[model samples]
Target: MTSTLSRAIVNYPNRFDPGVLSELPEHLQETIQRRNNVLGPGYTLIYKEPVEFVAGHGAHLVDRDGNDYLDAYNNVPCVGHAHPHVVEAVARQMAAVNTNTRYVQESLVDYAERLLATFPEELSKISLACSGSEANDLAVRVARYHTGGEGIIVTRWAYHGITREVASFSPHLGTGSPLGPNVRLIDPPDPRLAAPGSTLAEHMRKQVRDAIDDLERHGYRLAALVTDCAYTSDGIFTDPVGYMHGVVEEVHGAGGVYIADEVQSGFARLGDSMWGFSRHGVLPDIVTMGKPMGNGLPLSGVVFRPEVSDEFGRNVRYFNTFGGSSIPVAAGAAVLDVFEMENVQQRVLENGTALRAGLEEITKDSAYVAEVRGSGLYVGVEIVKDRATLEPDRARTEDVINDLRDRRILINGTGQSANVLKIRPPLAFTSDDVTRFLETFAEVAKDRL
Candidate 1:
């Protein structure tokens, strides 16, 4: 990295400066513009205007124009953008050792043990894969093989990955059977629709019970429940905690495995815990993790109950060429170290509290804003046509995302309807950053939302 980039970290998250990109060599500018053109027309957190990135440091993303963006959309940079500690660890390991799973790599073994240390005791065996999709597929295989069942249940607006098998379990297709039969679907028990005295947890329990019964009647005993710890595809934090406990218990009671899809909600992003399942106080039989695992590296895995692994082993040969490869292990080890030394999770808790409060403050007395729900750095601002009606104003939500980008702030949207303004910033996001984002959001909403 250049000294200019080195110096940028000291004053992170500064307002993006278009001049930096302008100052790029003529060829680079042409290439950047061409690249922007290639993206064509699309709803995105970024656009052609002032679009270019040069460097990153800690909690900021610097465009080619040297404009620093407060990184609230990058979990891949969990230890913070281009963290030197992780870079150095990766470099040293790459220089010394990096090989396939066929070798005796200490990094892999060490990382596996360290990773397992953070999981629940019941989760004792792990199988590494290259991406969240691969991990999800493996988890499903393990679940079905272990349970000797063929059914899977997922929530509406659920996203596992792009793999064919995982895709079959994903509700991203919404109104299609492309995901295969025997895959039961249900809505995430969003607290907004709750009865006067029904707790979110209790409501989810009822939903899980009903789904299980319906699936059983259809001659399909569930093999597993694959769900984002938070149903993040619907929105950032669906607060799947209380409801998750019920889901897991129900799955186990039905002789199915509870597969926690921690691809989005793991590694302390929720704060106060390493895994999202920990937040629910229930141990899942299988846990599929990715997203922030290697902080953006192509690495993911499934951790399961030992008995399940033994059962799976009896049926299929478990193998992946790059599973737990040396580089991923090195990067993962560094992430774990950073998680401890920097106390990143604790920082998430602190900043999460501040950010949520700031968002709530912006929505106060506003007709455009409905509710702000989430935990830790992962959050969602529900845009509504009318708060009392709980209707999603999709167009206005899109406008909010566009306007935020126009103002040089980075953010995005989620949900099947694409209306929840998502705030899943990197764990390194700070209070001042939160204040700035909310201030811009409030300003934008006052004018258009």
Candidate 2:
């Protein structure tokens, strides 16, 4: 059984505790109270002591008092915060026109063409949406329509989105959002969990096969197996490349399509490739992307093979009020422009390699450091109470993150125990940022771990 401490800390590892309100600055305390009064209990803030950012540029943020913070956890502004190119494109489009897809828009068509070019040849069709939730929700509908099945499989702690349909499979949302009856949870492809002689592929394939059989037992046929290729919410498991091949094979054998949720792992976040699914060497039937597509604008989309979406497209009329709007499309195009102009993929690879090496060096002698794992900019540092036991240290992980926050560095935690330090900054993160983070993290680990 999981401990109460682990369960309580799993969701928001560094969330500010309301019990310590009096310890904060008077102004922040008042602001928190006002925010709570207006936003209600649905919203939560990060860090033991929360911060309010007034501005951001590149890989840094400025607080209310003008203190600079190194941002090592945000993935929304993949190119960078307030990037001039994206800003100019959005402003220019907004000044000219901002309308829905019903209108004839050259920018939307051009952007869609360019975006689709980045994907595999078979994934030729694109459908735009406002958020990852909507994209995943639509992907579910398409999968069910294509396969004539209602069952979906997701990782045990996966977080796809918040929409009613998407959240039904997002087990990381916690107990308040119970999984749907047709949803089956499988353990993430963690190499550590693999049997001694077996490969990660074998282990994952077995789990998927078990899930399909159980779904069948419940009178539900397989529709799709959806997962974030990076496994961000499930401890950032990105090792043993091609481990998903067998899993995808199992899913296909069970008559289910594969949906790669790239909200956190797409657009060169992984350095080596544009999409995380590419790292697995498996072609997904449907690929859903969001978060970084329009820099900070609300933009998301689903790209799939024509055959998979043909029947649905022909039978059902689909339109979103502001999904493929001109302004967001312009911003997305500008992001692609940055990717080309700045050679962001190479930069991510170099910076990510240096960052991981620095982290590994710093945590080498520490007993609390279980492992350093990830690909490219998306990395995780697992924390454990005992190296031998590998028991997750949720409290220590929270302390380390909050300590970094106090030092004007921002990061977060993930996984079921919330003990994995998640360091996924913008693709623009530089060697300087990596150095600063390593030095600060070493200092914090010395004091806290």
**How far out, in Å, is residue 447 in model 2?**
1.8
lDDT per residue, candidate 2, 1-449, as tens digits?
34543453446667778899999999999999999888844477888788999999999999989999999999999899999999999999889978999999888999999999999899999999989999999999999999999999999999999988888999888876778999999989888888999888888899999999999999999999999999999999888787788888899998999999999999989999999998878899999999999999999999999999999999999999989999889989999999999999999999999999988988899999999999899999999999999999999998888889889889999999899999999888998999899889889978876
| Residue 440 miss distance in model 1 (angstroms) | 2.3
Candidate 1 weakest lDDT stretch, 10 residues:
8-17
Q: How many angstroms is residue 306 displaced in model 2 relative to the true structure, after the best TM-score fit?
A: 0.6
lDDT of 1 by residue, 33-104 (tens): 676677753212233244557788777888766777776777888788888888998899879877888878
- Worst lDDT run of 10 residues, candidate 2, spans 1-10
Residue runs of model 2 more than 4 Å from their true location after superposition: 1-10
Among these predictions, the greatest lDDT belongs to 2
- CA lDDT of every candidate: 0.78, 0.92
